[model samples]
Target: MGAATAATYFRILTEGPHVHRNLSTPQLVEAALARGEASLAANGALVAYTGSRTGRSPRDKFIVEDEETRTRVDWGKVNQPFPPEKFEALLERVVRHMAERDLYVMDLFAGADPTYRLPVTLVAEYAWHALFVKQLFIRPEMSELASHAAEFTIIAAPEFEAVPERDGTLSSTFILSDFTRKIILIGGTKYAGEMKKSIFGVMNYLLPERDVFPMHCSANIGPEGDTALFFGLSGTGKTTLSADPLRMLIGDDEHGWGPKGVFNFEGGCYAKCVDLSEEKEPQIFHAIRFGSVLENVVINARTGEPDYSDIRHTENTRAAYPIEFIENAVIPGIGGHPKNVLFLAADAFGVLPPIARLTPEQAMYHFLSGYTAKLAGTEAGLGSEPVPEFSTCFASPFLPLAPRVYAEMLGERLRQHGADCWLVNTGWTGGAFGAGRRMSLKHTRAMVHAAIDGRLAQAEFVTEPAFGLSIPTSCPDVPAELLNPRNAWPDKHAYDAQARLLAKKFEANFAKFDALESIRAAGPRVSR
Candidate 1:
């Protein structure tokens, strides 16, 4: 199917008598309540449940393999190929199923910068899903809405299940993206994150062709106009760290580095709410308000208070709200080229240093490696233990193109802009997860601030023998002992053994990447 076929299908899907177009937040909330789709919490945030699947179903996602994407998309376990004919048939079924229901339509923008902005139309089976996307994506003004035409259309019918045998899907859930048709079809899952991430995958493919480097990271501007980026997977504190009181938040996740600067790909934030508290994360805690949407968060029936601690439904509890909910948020969500870029890893093994400066080659090496622990409850199928994996470019799940495409773009930009890069472990310290405690948010924040403000640049540095990272000897507000991971461990030999193990893992992982000798040599030096 081509763009013309997609346009015709979109017209058929929207022509239903029960279609609701561009509903306001209040209207959406009311509709959700009336349809028994959601209930309002005491704080007025809509509480919704995603049945069966509570997190993203990455295994079921597929991209149509056609002439347009056959040669471009990096087909692999991550970017799985779906037969174009299968997609066309499945899309027809989804459109027909959705046309019969009361659909909620939302037209939104993906990028904050108009130059690179992507107009998106979301056709949702649930009113709450529409509200979720409305808050999550850029809501155009009435003036812009009058002339808004979607470059891409997402048809989401969570209730419609795909027959795996007939549809050629792995399961009942399916997230199929067709570049030729410019349509994303999602069904058999109510996980709203699928909708958010599918578009990110699309942007990851589309932006590189336009000379924009798409990133799975958070961005914020310091008081002096210096911009910093936080690249990490979920539970690594990208949203929490970027929501700093002193800095102006550009965006919490998903951004693009273009010729002008960095621009947010999202209008709002989808922050993890597991164990969320006002004391620990005041900005995110308070941001959940009237217009916000809370997913799978347990609420008190009598008092209607949300228990952020409760995770009976899932550990991936989330809060989605407009960026304006955060104080001192940049309206257009655009910032200058980042002066500092930090790669965060929740090292469950407690082997990596808390903070370390990186050479340009080391930065590229780590960027390609994209090492991070996969914490439980963050995804659909995960146990309590943190699973260590290297998500290429910190966004392998979302990147449709080859890893080198993003890695090369980042290298060129870093060289052109002269941005300093650092590695900050936000995971465990002293010993592995079973033995040690998580790194203090206070200490991590102090170190991050120091790096962002150039305080760490002035500090003396020493090489870490195992990984070859430059460990800062001293940092303001941080204890000197905590600056080095080895010193924090009770057993020196045990720490060395753990560090050596991690170094071996790094060496093994980096061997898979086809990079320059300099970049490869920049990796951890596993000692004999």
Candidate 2:
């Protein structure tokens, strides 16, 4: 069984009496309510719960090691190899399970740009999952839907649990992708993010072959037509910072850098809702309305309002809404080549500069290192404290190919386009997580605006010895002492010790990457 067999199964399922194809938002929401899958919030947003699993199960994800991907895919812990035979069997089981239930199907586009957009078909077992993807992915016009044909299909049966012994899965939940068959199979977990990110993984593998650099970053454009990208992992402020009221947001996450320019890989945003407030993030707060889907957010039973502070379910609560819900979002989500690129790091160790300008080599080094403290609740097994780790290109989980593929592509694009690069630590400051406070959002925003608007370029710079990053002497609307991390720390010796430890971590991580001498030399100056 292969692509042809998979296609035949999908056609049978779609044409079956239990199938509901292309249901509108209202109809899907109604269906979800009737099925008791979700409830309506006071603000009219649909609130759903992902029982047991609140975040992605990376260990459970597998990519088929068929003849097509045998040499192309990077076979390791991240891209775990699943036997082609096992995948076909698992897919058959999932399809059979879905065929017995009321299936909801949605056809959507992944990329905003027509030239590179991927036509996707999602076969879901729940109506809310259909609503979730409908809002998260680009919706086509009525006329376009008439001729729509999916290049890839995702068969998701959340209620259908896999038999680990027979399916070769670590747990009951499984996310299996077969590039040769052009199909993704998901089961056991109801977390809708698996569906969204599976497509992202596909794009990450497909686009680079087409000379397009697929990025896991947020993008926005200024009034002067200058576009900027914010690269970071979840809970790193990529979505919060890019939703600038003054600029038009291209997308919150997932984009492609092609010959035309930067284009959004999604039609909407999936923003973290932990401690979310209108006063802090007005755009995201307001964007949650009638058509949006809120996952695991605690709604007050008495008032029906959402309590963003509640973490009983999980700290990784989320809100998904169309980009148009944001008043300043750019329709079609296309922009000119970025004038600036910022690498965001949540340094829980509190040693990195508040903001620093990166030379091309330094940019490449950090891009490969992609160091950031893994915040709690962002993933399933993470502890409460922020753990320091390097997620290559800030997107190791989604990349099916090797890290070098993305890094080389980024280096080429930055050189050809001459985009300015900066490193901003949106993490802790002064001491560490428990000892020091998180960086001020206002101050971070001021520094970001200064860097992108060309104000910080004229400021004097001092080289930090630990990471060899150029720290600006001053930034408008930011305190002078706060620009340097050592100045804010009460115990300078303690700060130095932490810096040395982090520098060693960087050195150890970079040792594995086979990069140019200059790129390797750009890493931290670890003093033994």
Candidate 3:
């Protein structure tokens, strides 16, 4: 099997536990095989794996396929409607073929070993292609790609080729740039490496300059044709907040900004699926009904479908697929100048003001201070407490451009189109999330509704003490009880203490950018 096969197994591993839950053994098997075939077809088997043999690896272990013919271009995956009930039919065929031929499948990460009655190795084996494509779209760099490899090998231009699987050797992509490539073996997360390679192969020599800059943001286009950009690090509710009923979601993560406007680099959205509650965020919950790709999510034992609100199995919960998976996902996932830009921060320290209309300088300052809480299980301790962390631009690790470049582009776009910018805190209301309490989803939703309806535009405002930000006293139709931080603070002292600490954190986090004050933005953060 090729990297395409790796993708098939990844689907099985992530949504595997759910595939046969509602069905019997025969039906489940059929569904599994059918799902695999559909994935291969939908992900573009006709294009990706079709190149002629180019060369062999230095070890003579693998062969590199044709690069020009390869679909280095983009492809979309409508995962849900594919193969449909034919899963049972395809399952019946694969089982009979494998069993009749006495071919025992080796499952790299088999859960309880499949009942196929054949020898199975429950190891971790997911494809590196998807991540490669994602990397290419978001952060295409040879050195960056190498750092995500299987064995931590250094990356260089094509010097060696990959051998084929039938040669009794492993054939993988080393680096994606110059025709020559080899696969690295990532133990637990096997897919990140190959995915990075395929992505880089696209612009290896094609583009004259890397003008497109990758951003950690969600994008949406309003009915009025204006796009609203939401930039945040993980956990600030970018995915949850941007899935608005009134607008079209361009994409949830990873956008590429160019002269044409902002285009979502990813065909899909990588959402934080941990402990997901549909009732709380009905829009996101409803988006995953079918055809959406589930990644590392835990399913209920009985239903075989995802239990979004449950975070017991994993904290690094995610899903990947074309934006169309969501009912209102934008087709091209690109849009023009945004009328509104939001910088979301999950302020754990809670010292920052609730909301502020930022100046371009302040916007850049907060954009680089991407703050949020880590999911409980993603770090060292599982079923334990979450740790709050901050990353510049909420994307220092994976962004394709310098922070100034992104900020400049954002400023220019907003200035050119006359956009309004806001720094919204989604972290904590009282002291901090773990120390105090998380702001209610209802309240956040209410605030968003108010903003959407223009109810808060003329609301009473006061300059926040710490950041000198404007805070609105009330939003129309929202409860008076939920307007300010004090309402959520049972102990005012704790709230004040946490807020100060959080502000200090931001100041320290932004110390690196003190020298970039002279950088010019695309436009002022606020105003026409």
Candidate 4:
């Protein structure tokens, strides 16, 4: 077998078939090794394999592979069709497998440093697959047969430390005393049980002593003390929009809040890659070529490496790489008082104002409504789920604590800093998918343009009934041609039909929140 063939086998076994579940792991490994020598021969200087070792330290790593293991799960496909429960299931399985192997997982991803890795949650089998195969933990000798038969097992768990758990590690067992011992960073949407070798990569070495909370928001440390924070549920373009080539992106996704404002938990961005294109997403497309980590993506039919469109294996298309991958990814994902805090809601109903200048109450109302999508069935006959639906703050799960914890934190941060907030509806303004094209990424970009350009900061604000928020009727940097949904509506009648339908939706959805304090007059302070 040649390099391509070897790569193909490895891709299929680890990323291809089993990732989608077509072949067994052992079979894939054997075939990949069989093709390894040929791959090395064709590539000339290419080493047959490479790997790292696991040490007794809080952050210890060792890898050695020679024609043995040198493949990774596609980096771009990490979070496709992100089912909150499914990811959690995967992590739980990894814990089970760790117990089976007696190999304890430890991590120490914390601090205000930008080089550090963000936290993630991976399922068990996937985690096992990532480590042993992708990271080349298990190696082969001159003889492939013996290498194939290496026994694998699990034995025990260390006693939980009676001492205070600062970052979650046994201080005594740690070979590296100076290090904080923990399994992995738990920031972002990573649930506990999934396979998360990606987490291991960043955590292998981290700057010591800082609390980085797992959050899902874009961050940028502005030139001044001003920091701009952008929040959106997945697929709403948090990473893509927050990342401006001209402006420095502090961090694309997760951040850690501490005494001196908030710092980024990740050194980079973990972006979605399905239907990715340089034309539409030049930054993300270009990032994948260098330091970017592509997950679960199909490769070019000829390259046998990544196929951005091959979401068949999993809809969780993703790319994880440092913000540096973008020429402007800020080194330390930290920022100060936000100049603008944008709450992203991909409104599927298309009834909400295109870009609303929000009052604190409406901000909380939309945040609680958490509206932005209807997930259509990838299957042939499965009925479509409502695209525009409400989720608590649009983040249905993944806060180890509670929604209010984050809300309070957000409010406190904004208040002390004296920042302004906005609600940008990136979803359908004219109609939902089938009825009309979903909101244009262009329009969303324009809204963001007006935002950073300071136009939205001074636009005339109008009060909306259902949300009781303010919508900016005019703003600079934002094209006058695209202020309203009508600008994008091709058919006025169809647009109106969808508009009425969405209006009904708002009425219906708000009814639920009517009694809730966040949106209720009596609930929590909707706005200060």
Candidate 5:
């Protein structure tokens, strides 16, 4: 293909010896099927398997350690440093590796709002990956695509393995981004999420420069045009809670709060499907259809139906489908300024109230802390125990900037909009995971409704001494006792012990955050 047209869209595709331009979804699906990269499941969804690596390899991700990005990024374990020359060499190798192969390319937009949207060109060695991106990002009209220029480019080559020694990489798998060059390189992994997250990372880096606060959250709108933002790390019910049948979903995972309003950073939802039930998550369960891509999900060989309970492949089973797949999704995926911003946590310790209202300072503190429990098996290291982990901004791994960059933006927006903030625990009750019962979805829904409908605001608030959270004395449909953790626990002393331990953990974690003493003081204090 000619370099002029492809290069204008993405320079990386032109650098590659061969470039394929803008293949239709049907054409790409055919190419994927012919190459045996994907197969049609019994349910008519595309079944793709990423051998060995089913989830994102966060440790393998790196940012170019050059003049342009060296000072810009938070360089350490999470944002590892990769030599610019090494990145150049890797790019050359990646380009050459795909030179002889039939490549697939698609140009799409990232942000849904026109003001902040980024034109992205996705270049993939696997046709299925191209189709996946097409579904996961905003598709441009034919006329727009003709003259579309990509602000960023992604070149994914899963078949190309890096040499750790030669490439100066930790392993054969690498996901490196060079902001100065506006290009991202992926190799040695077939997990489609890597591609999805890399684009979000690019936005996380670029948007803040333009004063946009990019978020790892879900957003939705009520009929009265009121908007709400749900912030949480994975396994925290962001997708499930945001997909309310009574509300219109703006987007499920990534979004940007800019001058205009809250806009979806992605065009689709990549929902975790472990133990997903049709009755529990009806919207997500039904969104799996003909064009959906089922990643690492086990399917019955005979029936062709997905066995969501099967962890043989991975606990990180996922489904990727367009946002429109959800029945009540907001077309164009945009929403007004949020009236409420919720910080969701799955507190396995069960010491936190099922729901609590947050002051502005507490909101900033919690937003910065991004505290949540890490369930075992989510990573390689833990046993079946629940461990507390802090992911700053609910997306520390994907954040290229310092935590304060996002936190400060959030505080400013919340104050500017006069938005109410909340902390809701969708975890265990009475005791820790093993000793306690998981909070019922019915009760959680009722509590959220109360928060949104102004019922919780009118209720009497009693401050939880250990956590310094103002828990409501009663909610509309939720029981009075469930509102307070101490009341819910049979042994108040045991609850006090767990509360103290959790408060200490929060203090220790917040010490790492170099913010003003006032913002730091916004955290919890355990009363003796």
Candidate 6:
């Protein structure tokens, strides 16, 4: 859509002459607060609440089942099929509802690499939502905006609710994407994640055809120009680990690895803010200042201070800020081919070692498996107690293609780049959640630093019996006792039983993949 055409589309719905276009941060913050959509916190951050729905509703997300996406997309539980007529009807309702209302529109790009970047047009009902995409997406310079054109457009009207029977929707909350029209529709939910993730899903669909691997991971580069990638599901420390002080952060979440190199898919970082502290995470701590957006975070009304520890709203509390907010962030957020790739899993079972090396075949196997502990409050249905589940590619919900498509891309990238891969468990140890404790951040950081610095390569390694992974006996500044999962446990028998049980789970999950025998053999060996 061209700029003039986009303005005309908004004009059809807008009753007044009030259409805000690419407002500055200060202007957006002031407009949000003045309109009673947001409040200023003690730290000078804008705190906005996404009522009822604090996380992305994957169940409510659907892709229009048309000739364009019917056969191309992996249709299943995550990528639910929506009738073409249903989407068209919903779009009409949304348009009528939004009509006669002042709208906030922001035109931006999704990728940092200009070669592969996507020009996006975001039309939102709320000022905070406008400010959100403004922070999350790459802002175009005045010169760039003059000749700007949008490849995809997103229209978010959270106030409008759908009737399932009348609208042919599952619920009042609906997020539908019609790629053929290059448009996305979201309604009945104020959660801004839906807006951001919908574009990510689009990239996941379109980029693969261009031989670009869109990853749900974080990337960073060292002072020596060594780049590393961390792949994991939410609450698995992909953001925390990637925001290293010594290394320049490329991005906290979502990236694309292609023939050129690795480039961040986002211009902002959406970090989990529950229990956030300045002492522990100073980088993220400092990032939350003027113009940053805090979602579902409880704030002290009197003092205007944010209670990061409060879960009254939801444990999925988050802080969204521009990439430049991080003091050590790399500008243009691009990095060379990664020298190391770390697959992070929060192992609630406490069976997997804190760190283990992966062979090339094993890397592909685990990449497809995408094992991780489902943390509480990370999703709509999950409980406090961690549940072990396999999320294919660490992002099954967002992926539009088959799992094998991404697995093959990852395998090819690793081999072509000669990157070393490792599985790092950032969850419990000694026993399951109740019996064991979460891995210390300091210790995990130490081990990660060692791995990135090539110090772990010189350390003595022992083969772990349960999964057949090589674990280092010693890591600088980390306790030797914590290196082995068996040694950390007081009861060796309990550890062995738990390890074998986890191995069985891995085997069962891997069986579903129609891969070569060698790739399957790379999986865990569980003795019956």
lDDT (Cα atoms) of all candidates against the true structure: 0.92, 0.93, 0.48, 0.47, 0.89, 0.89
Candidate 1 local lDDT, residue 302? 85
Each model's TM-score, in the order given? 0.97, 0.98, 0.61, 0.61, 0.96, 0.96
Write model 2 residue lDDT over 1-528, tens digit each, in one string: 856885689786688789999998999999999999999999999999999999999999999998899999988989999998898888888878877899999999999999999999999999999999999999999999989999889888899998899989999999999898888899999999999999999999999989999999999999999999999987789999999998999999999999989999999999999999999999999999999999999999999999999989999899999999999999999999999999999899898999999999999999998888876666669887667889999999999999999999999999999999999999989888889889999999999999999999999999987888899999999999999998899999998888888888888888889999999999888556
Native-structure RMSD, model 1: 1.6
Query: What residue runs in model 3 are displaced by over 4 Å at the alpha carbon?
Result: 1-188, 191-213, 375-378, 381-388, 486-488, 516-528
**Tens digits of per-residue lDDT for model 4, 384-476:** 645555655554433323455455555555566666777787766555665655667777777777776677777776564443556677765
What overall lDDT, based on C-alpha atoms, would model 4 receive against the true structure?
0.47
Task: Choose the strongest candidate by lDDT.
Answer: 2
1-528, model 3: which lDDT tens digit per residue? 356654553344324432211122233223434434112223221111112222112222111233432333221210011121222232223323222221111111100111111111211111222222221222222453323322111121121233324212234332222122222211111223223322222222222135544566788877778787788876788998888777889878656555566776555555666677666766666555333445445554565666556655444555544455578877656777566778887766555445657766666666666667664545566455445576766665433224565556565655766677787878766665466666666677667656654666778877655456767877665565545665567887666665566555555556656436433231122211
Best-to-worst TM-score order: 2, 1, 6, 5, 3, 4
Candidates in descending lDDT order: 2, 1, 6, 5, 3, 4
* lDDT winner between candidates 3 and 5: 5
- Give the higher-lDDT candidate: 2 or 3: 2
Stretches of candidate 2 exceeding 4 Å from the true structure: 2-4, 375-386
TM-score of 6: 0.96
lDDT of 5 by residue, 428-492 (tens): 89888888888988999899878987788999998988888899998988889788888888988
